[model samples]
Target: MLIGELAEQAGTSTRMLRYYEAHGLVRPERTANGYRCYDEAELRVVREIRGLLAVGLGLDDIRPFVACLRAGNPSGDACPDSVAVLRRKLAEVDDYIDQLGAVRRQLQTQLAHAITVRPR
Candidate 1:
C-alpha cells in the first residue's frame, strides 16, 4: 500500500511514517514511479515502533529491539543485549513513575493548602 493507506492502517499520520523512515525505523520499497510502497511486515514494524514510542522509548533505543524482531529472533529474549536494553528501559520508567508520583503528592498537598487559605 501507499504511505497514506499504510498510515491509516497503522493509526498514524503519513508525516509520522516519513519521520520513522528518516529515523531508520521503517524501510518501504520505492515504486518505479517513485511512490513509497509498504508491505505487511513494514506495517507491523510501524505498529511496533509506535508502541515503543508510546512507552517512552527513544528511536535510538528501539533500534536493537526492532533489529532483533526483523532478524526473526524466535524468543526475542534470545538477544542478551536486547534484554539489557529492556531492563534499562524498565528502570527508567520506574524512576519516571516515582518522580511523577512525588509531583502528584506535592500538587495534592498544595491544593489542599490552597483550599484552606483565605483569598486576599
Candidate 2:
C-alpha cells in the first residue's frame, strides 16, 4: 500500500511514517514512480515502533530493538544485549515514576495546606 493507506491502516499520520523512515526505524520500498510503498510487514513494524515510542523509549534505544526484532529474534528479550537495554530502560522508567510520585504527593500536600489556610 501507499504511505497514506499505510498510515490510515496503522492509525498514524503519513508525516509520522516519514519521520520514522528518516529515523531509520521503518523502511518502505520506493515504487518506480517514486511513491513510497509499504508491505504488511512494514505496517507491523510501524505499529511496534509507535508502541515503543508510547512507552517513552527513545528512538536511539528503539532502533537496536527493532533491528533485532527484524533480524528474526522473535522477541527483544531473546537478544542478551537487547535484554540489557530493556532492563536499563525499565530502571529509568521506575526511577522517573518514583520521582513523579514524590512530586505529586508534595504538590497535593501543599495544595491541602493552602486550602486550609485560605478560604476560596
Q: How many residue pairs clash in each candidate?
A: 0, 0
lDDT of each residue in 32-80, candidate 2, tens digit only:
9999999987877888777878888888878777777788776544677
TM of each candidate vs. truth: 0.76, 0.78
Superposed model 2: Cα runs more than 4 Å off: 101-120
Q: List model 1 lDDT by residue over 1-120, tens digit each.
A: 999999999999999999999989899999999999999888878887888788788888778767877888753335777788789999998998999999999999999999999598
Q: Residue 13 CA error for candidate 1 (Å)?
A: 0.6
- Judge candidate 2 against the unseen true structure and give its global Cα lDDT, from 0 to 1: 0.86
Task: Give per-residue lDDT, candidate 1, residue 101.
Answer: 100
In model 1, where do residues sit more than 4 Å from their true spots? 74-78, 99-120
Q: lDDT of each prediction vs. the true structure? A: 0.86, 0.86
